[model samples]
Target chain A: MSDTAQAARAVIGDSEFDRDTAVTLREPGVYGIDLSAGWTIINAVNGGYLLSVLGRALADALPHSDPFTISAHYLTASQPGPAVVRTDVVRTGRTLSTGQASLFQYDDEGREVERIRVLASYGDLDSLPDDVRTSVKPPSFPPMEQCFGPEDGPAPVSGSSAIAERLMLKLDPATLGWALGSPSGKGEMRAWFGLADGRDADPLSLLLAVDALPPTAFEIGLSGWVPTVELTVHVRSRPAPGPLRVSITTRNLAGGFLEEDAEVWDSADRLVAQSRQLARVRVG
Target chain B: MSDTAQAARAVIGDSEFDRDTAVTLREPGVYGIDLSAGWTIINAVNGGYLLSVLGRALADALPHSDPFTISAHYLTASQPGPAVVRTDVVRTGRTLSTGQASLFQYDDEGREVERIRVLASYGDLDSLPDDVRTSVKPPSFPPMEQCFGPEDGPAPVSGSSAIAERLMLKLDPATLGWALGSPSGKGEMRAWFGLADGRDADPLSLLLAVDALPPTAFEIGLSGWVPTVELTVHVRSRPAPGPLRVSITTRNLAGGFLEEDAEVWDSADRLVAQSRQLARVRVG
Candidate 1:
């Protein structure tokens, strides 16, 4: 349609995820982002998808490539439209590099609105020590064939979540009560996350995998609109190039807010990433 | 003592916890910090105590007083000395205020070094809905009297931890093996934390409480030095005055790194705060 769109597609590749989160450098520190309409969670874009878009820009601008820790505060709900990402390199150390990225969009009134602010550290994940010791066992679920695969069709939980279209998510049937009108009364969700186009997951895409599940509170019968306020992701290691096993658990909910903790294990049964997020909840 | 120290003490009050975390306004965006020698974990200042010092400045600079969510990345080890804190108010919204604060100390070469960088969201915790629904149970511990009280004497696990002197911590005997010759092979620690001076626990001090316990890895026989790389704290509610029950658990350790998750429950048995931290480990 436009030269910028064609150019971004050329650089970002053919995958829907890659094409949607693709960023084009506008200047030394500015990046032009075209948010895709195919990644909405309801009326707004998914916070995790928004984070990946910002992460891509940070990976390019910073000296280090992989993000060890990234923290983002969502200021407002973002829509599918044109936005700009501005990154500032905070510190470049021997092992880790810290940076900040902010996404801004224009309001209908033609005013610049800041959508999200992120602080992150980037380093090569492969450079980390190749050893693992875990006190917690990997989550137990039925084999990939036993769970409800994405091919079974879409679950219309969110009115218009185009995100359900791009990413293929397989949920454990035991925890799928929230979508069947009879919530299981448990504040937990376990699923397998991957791309429909068969694109392998990398450290950048794992950012999305962490927040890709339905709200954990939904299973507990508090099916109100949950908006993420802040999210922090710790990328421990690179994924093993297959669908990721993801589990999100909510332990506490108070003061109209709740905390969701997520752990993702790769196909090789290794813990790849962990995340903790806080969101505002409306109790019905 | 310098005038700045005296003035800071005068403004911060008589509590040892308050005096150490005191902040004095030096300019519009900068506050002076006098790191006390009493909060060292081993050779460096405690990461949680350092976060509180920064939080105090953020509380004074931002429009909101209580920190809803705060995330900090440790760049370098900090020593007992004078450091300056620079805060930037990113956005002031109707419900939440977002800001960033960086703590800087002068290195031996006279160059300014950023010891820690933080991004936080502040809000009125009192304004939140007074409702609680928890899927997870609060950690149970023996009565405070049964645990190893601070009045009994100091545990010489850390050669020089003045923090143990300022904060009266009572460790659950079951988890105190690391302090003795034998370290249990479990990666968890539980303790009751309070101020020796009888100062009550507040939202700001809760930041310190989350990290007051010894590293959880120690309990697992990994007695090596563990330094925090990134920490995120979500203040769920205001604490009821009294000692706080704290527990730290490490579930995963990989690539010379580990994740420590902590939960703090108030005297009223309400979940007050929760934190997740990632740290670097040197295996011996």
Candidate 2:
């Protein structure tokens, strides 16, 4: 096995099955799985598990696929808990390969959990239609060299939560000296994300990694406390190789709820992915 | 008027702009903005524009006081459009007198074109805790009687586009309904909904209405198309009111380049609204 693959397996397996797993195949590049524990607690399977399994199967079905960069967007857990995943390739087209997978979690009695349908495609990146336009821009802030890491200073009040600490440790204010790429080659970035534990993870891990950041980011900006009810992300493209930097902005928040949308850009200003999340606020 | 009140008027008009002006005062209630245009062409002014304005203002404020409801849900301009609405108390919470309003459209020059918001609260209804649940049941098929306005031998598709005709005319074999009040005396609901026009509209619109289908009567089944990019709903109780039903599902074409989410729902088993949408699909 390659060193990269070995390292990935180590981190994922070491972490209580919390990270997404990717497997490379000759036909469609690489496949991945987003696993979870089901609500039954006894069965050890759930909704997210099924979706992750499905994701992996889809990835394996494509031809002319890029093994270097493959991923699945948001796969949700309809019913909470640990779940198992399985994948299968649907078809391989000239330009694109299609794949599907199923997520299964058990009920209290060890019955099958709800199933989720997984769909994925692989191939040369396609250009957006002439009419579709992105209004998001890369965020400008202090560079990594000048910024303080979470451990470098006292953690922010919001950083008290484990999720918050994980986020702060993964993100940098600026994107200097990072590899970048995007379909448009103009407005997104990706970098080698430095985790507190000193391990590098994939885009799916990065997503789980950053999910808790917006609330912290926003809370610090507002100088208050904000709790997120749920967070959802849409991956447009993967970040280029290197330390990752994410550019985000607040779209809108109403009815005690806040929505923040982000355009994840590679260091080269390419649109790697787009994410949006909803959060509930707790006033001081 | 207070400084905040006066400043608000400068940007929006006075509270008494029009009976259907779209913006109304309601302590604790969210502000409403309606964006609807006459048939031929529905511009952003009626929807996106209004949301942009209301979203911005709401962001500046914190924790409102009045209780509000989303009475209507549909599609416009092939996109998801939701009106932030507010309700004002007529009897000051004594006898349950209240008024509601919303701003629909904003012209190219940023003026409202079509808008609607309603005000209501259980008048003389018993004061209760957050103990309602949805008892409403979904139908096994479309409620043709309530949806077609009586002269129904199967509703005719009415729209300028052929695509719309196929969608509006094709009836799905599914049931739709909604239950109001609480099942376990908790304010919740179970609802079913689908397209009034029968054709698909936009994913975002379908999601918005599905998310806004009030609380279910029991453990309301939350299902829809589009894989739910993100979903967030809040309820004070369970068993909301009537058995509101919504039906939504979709199909993708062109190697999944584009897809749609279709939906329909009944108010008291009566057709209330319908929606459809387009989306970008990725295969994994």
Provide the overall lDDT of each model, using Cα atoms, as 2-decimal numbers. 0.85, 0.33
What is the Cα-based TM-score of model 1?
A: 0.92
- Per-residue CA lDDT of model 1 for B70-172, tens digit only, reads 9998888898998999999989987789999999999779888999999999999998877788777778899999888545656774435667666768889
Residue A1 displacement in candidate 1 (angstroms): 22
| lDDT (10s digit) by residue, model 1, range A180-278 | 788898888999888766777888888999998889888988876888889999999899877889999998887889998999999998888999999
Q: Which candidate is the best by lDDT?
A: 1
Candidate 2 lDDT, B1-284, residue by residue in tens: 12222333222122221112244334464554333332111122222223223322232222222222112111122222444444333223342222323334355686544332222121221242322122223436544444431123433212232212111222222211322122232223222333233222222222233433222211123222222111211111112233344544322122222222222343433222222222333322
The list of candidate 2 runs beyond 4 A from truth reads: A1-57, A61-82, A86-102, A114-137, A156-234, A279-284, B1-284
**Per-model DockQ against the true two-chain complex:** 0.74, 0.03
- Per-candidate TM-scores read 0.92, 0.38
The local distance difference test score of model 1 is 0.85
How many Å off is the CA of B104 in candidate 2?
32
